[model samples]
Target: MRNVVIGFLGTQLDMGKRRRWRPTVDLCRTEGFPVDRLELIHDHKFNRLAHSVKRDIEEASPETEVLLHRMDMDDPWDLEEVYTKLFDFASDYGFDEDRERYHIHLTTGTHVGQICWFLLSESRHIPAALIQTGPPRGGDDVGTFDLIDLDLSRYDALQQRFDQQTREYGDLLKGGIKTRNVAYNRLIDRIEQVAGLSDAPILLQGESGTGKSELAQRIYELKLQRRRVKGRLVHVNCATLRGGTANATLFGQRRSFTGQAGTERAGLLREADGGVLFLDEIDALGLEEQALLLHAIEAGQYYPLGSDAEVTSRFQVIAGASGDLSAMVSEGVFRIDLLTRLNLWTFHLPALRDRPEDFEVNLRHELAQAEKTLGIRVGFNSDASEAWLRFASAPGTLWPGNFRDFSGAILRLCTLAPRGRITRAQVVDEIATLERRWRAADTDQNSQLVAKYVNGPVDPFDIPQLANVLHTCQTSATISEAGRRLFAVSREDRKSRNDADRLRKYLAKFDLSWAELNDG
Candidate 1:
């Protein structure tokens, strides 16, 4: 079967000064070309311009079937969104490798589009070899092309070096955080690779106090160490930038405005001209600001509030948001284009509650941080330390604000500690205070039900099992349902699947019956 070819039409397809035999026609009409069908992806915005080129191809290449697809992209230069749309289209197209071989025409589309196609092909997402068209060396059609595969497997030496560098980057990210969780370590490893190479905008999504700012700072520090950035890191909290001041603070204004200042004030974008710019709480920023930010991020160009001249700021933006951006996009609040740019390299930092394994390691690090920052040594008394660790990591102990709360806990204890030593009294008070706060905030029926049914002073060692039981009970409609949910994964191993009986026995330890617990 003749190889099926897929390509996106760029503006140059018809707008170029060069005469007949445009790249699309040449790719199809070239002598001995093996195109069974040519799939052309075009944006509706350029419908009129694309129509002429589509007609020209049909008239010139009668042998190949030309199929046109209408794909829309808000910005041609925003490859992040462009790739996502194209990848989705390709995925849904569902190529049948058994029936026909495929080839991707790489000469068409924007430079951004071409790069995205190359990346998709490399990852096997496109499932095709590359077909690159160009002007002949001597006197041939410009669209006469050559087929090639990246064949990265052949470069053993380069691959080895890359693997080694990746390991080193991973080590650097974990140097100070002291994280022990395997999944978190892998996440940091991927982050290190992206941080070192791509200058594309990075979005760090998570809860309010889930270390997004700290990670961004570390990324900046890593970039600085590698000589990737020359200037200092500029951080802006979107929550702090409000109303009329938001635009002026981010984009800057000329010194000669109605409320003219003595000297010209550079905006945050300009301040981070050659380094990293981190925007925290990006969900709080205005929609207008997000639109301007899209231009700045995509093209590195933005006009100041009071200036007619456009300014350029080349900086890597690391944005942090606590909630879902897609929901904001649907709500018509956050610009989808801005979110698209930032979504290129998104890394969601798991909240402390999610990664319980890292709690002990992070807790120790927090205390160490207190010691280092305050120039004071504070050690936990044996009983006090045990009690605090047990309560902190146990199930139903909701750490509402994550590490931020944990940090405050350390500070409060450190401040109240007598003679630089934490005692039992302080630990109990801290636990009681935190529990009260979570109880007041947590209105979830499952949460309230768990607290009501579960035994007091949740043991840290039994946290996992207790949590599982509580969750099972909360979700199960009947005692049998809860037992089935718990045993579904392990039923094969158990000789007797006494789901309801098992659930009843377990609830007995908490001084409660299934009928009694179910009512709560």
Candidate 2:
């Protein structure tokens, strides 16, 4: 195979002295590694030097063919210009990998030029290996050369640096909270990647208080830090946008349209121009608004309220929804086309109950934040800390409100602490309050589930039992598991152990099936 060497003409080294072997000429003259062709790149001002170096290469290695290419640059140190020119050159160059091997000579260019070459080659825009030449050692005038292949996996330090950077990005997205849940950490990793790499609309689906809004803000901040965006973040709770004002609030309003003397208002989309727009509770947006948003996202232009001219605002959308958008689309409540655009990068944050391992870590984080906000440090005593830990790790501990409830609990504990020290008594009281709140919520939810299934009025005596049974069935993975738990004590005494049959018959009495309960 033929060998092609591409490099810049070293203005000083390739000129003046024969005693010091020129890097470009020596590369061609190097023993055992013969250059079949040399594609010499240089500024038009250095045309004389390029020809001089070319002549020297021809004399030193008669087998090598030297080709001169004049690439003019105002500032050789300007990275953008150098990269653009080099990228263009690479794009136009005919590469034959099967017949010829390409080598990018790194010793002869400016540092900026060298960096551009590395980037182009690493990204495979230039299909070549990098060859770096140094001064001659021993008897060889050709000098020592090192061939560097841009295989990231071969460089452990570089790979490790990339991994560390990804972890840092994940940490930023998590608001510096030390989370230990494996699934949650993986989710953050994926979000970090998407936030940095893509400008397509992102759909965040999760229950209320699961940090969708917070995550969107973190994504905005990350993109801003990376200089992907220049404008400020615009956060809008779609639930607050209602009736006629919803249109004005999102797409701006003209003073003439309102028949008022006030100045025209730039809406959330305009405010987020060149930045990010976080639409929390996006499912609450009216179908008409959703359609307009879809158009704005796709076209980067929209008609504001009472405005004849179209307003342009190029922004990325990060929408948050507590409910299932797909279900809403099926029910004809949400615009399917809008949902399709936002669903390009969909992420579902897990509920706090599903991420129990992260509860304690997040609790500590909340307490620290509270301390900073309240201007007082609060410490949980050993006994108090243990008590809280037990409650957090307990089986079937419902965190229906997710992180909001957890953070609120920590804030309450800190606020109610005496003299910056939370005692066991305070912890006990907080636990009782949380348990009562959870129980009442569970009871109400269970009653609603019962009402949905049963046709006639349920006997007052049977309400509590029916509610408990329904709650257990919904939480359990299968009828067998539900039956085992519901009849734990009574199952052992039975001669025939058919707990599932007993549970099925009981559910039948209420006109409910396990499948129906779960599907609902």
Q: Which candidate number maximizes TM-score? A: 2
Model 1: which residue pairs collide? none
- Could you give me the TM-score of model 2 versus the true structure? 0.73
Please report how far candidate 1 places residue 5 from its true position, in Å.
Answer: 36
Give the alpha carbon lDDT tens digit for every residue of 236-355 in model 1.
999888888888899988887656556466899999999989999999988888888888987889999889899999998999999889877866779888888889999988878778
Name model 1 segments beyond 4 Å from true.
Answer: 1-168, 440-520
TM-score of each: 0.55, 0.73
Worst lDDT 10-window in candidate 2: 13-22
Supply the global lDDT for candidate 1: 0.81
Model 2: CA > 4 A from native: 1-4, 7-27, 30-58, 62-102, 106-119, 125-127, 131-161, 444-520
